[model samples]
Target: DKKGKYTVLSEKLTSEPMGIGFKKGDKELEESVQKALDDMQKDGTLSKLSIKWFGTDEYKK
Candidate 1:
């Protein structure tokens, strides 16, 4: 509170992106994952899943 009075505060949370970590020599797995993601996006599955999980389709980025 400012001046001993009630005050409303608002702020945006900063965070980093999280992803799956893999061991060395996992190029094939990485490529597969990329392909799967691409397919999902092309087929609208990704957006549907995002809406289902996040309550909004904010995964286009």
Candidate 2:
């Protein structure tokens, strides 16, 4: 049996992509984080995590 429910507030509202904010001039850390995220996406770990946490892989389309 299912127990979850949801409603749409606005059809025009789309899912916005989120980002990690870093301090100014923190290029090295930002680049490293970006590389790690890219690697995770390439290896399917990101999708897996999304589904595990959000019930759906929202990152994929």
Candidate 3:
């Protein structure tokens, strides 16, 4: 096995969208969470956090 160092020699093979899940009939909670996420997105908070963790603003795209 190559252990000291390694490099990727292929292009991206797949992509998946992430999501948030909650109980099936909790419309109030769902709406609240959705609104919160929307607010973050609108205010640039999400982008900032994404850049902080991933080093790129993947969420904004």
lDDT of each: 0.75, 0.81, 0.81
Candidate 3 wrong stretches, greater than 4 Å: 1-14
RMSD list, candidates in order: 8.3, 5.6, 4.8
> How far out, in Å, is residue 48 in model 1?
0.3
Q: What is the lDDT of residue 12 in candidate 2?
A: 32
lDDT of 2 by residue, 1-61 (tens): 4456765343335567778999999999999999999999988999999877666776684
**lDDT for model 3:** 0.81
Q: How do the residues 1-61 of candidate 1 rate in per-residue lDDT, one tens digit apiece?
A: 3686874334324446658776788999988998998899988898999777656665677
Supply every candidate's count of residue pairs whose N, Cα or C atoms clash at under 3 angstroms.
0, 0, 0
What ranges in model 1 sit over 4 Å off?
1-15
Which 10-residue window of candidate 1 scores lowest in summed lDDT? 7-16
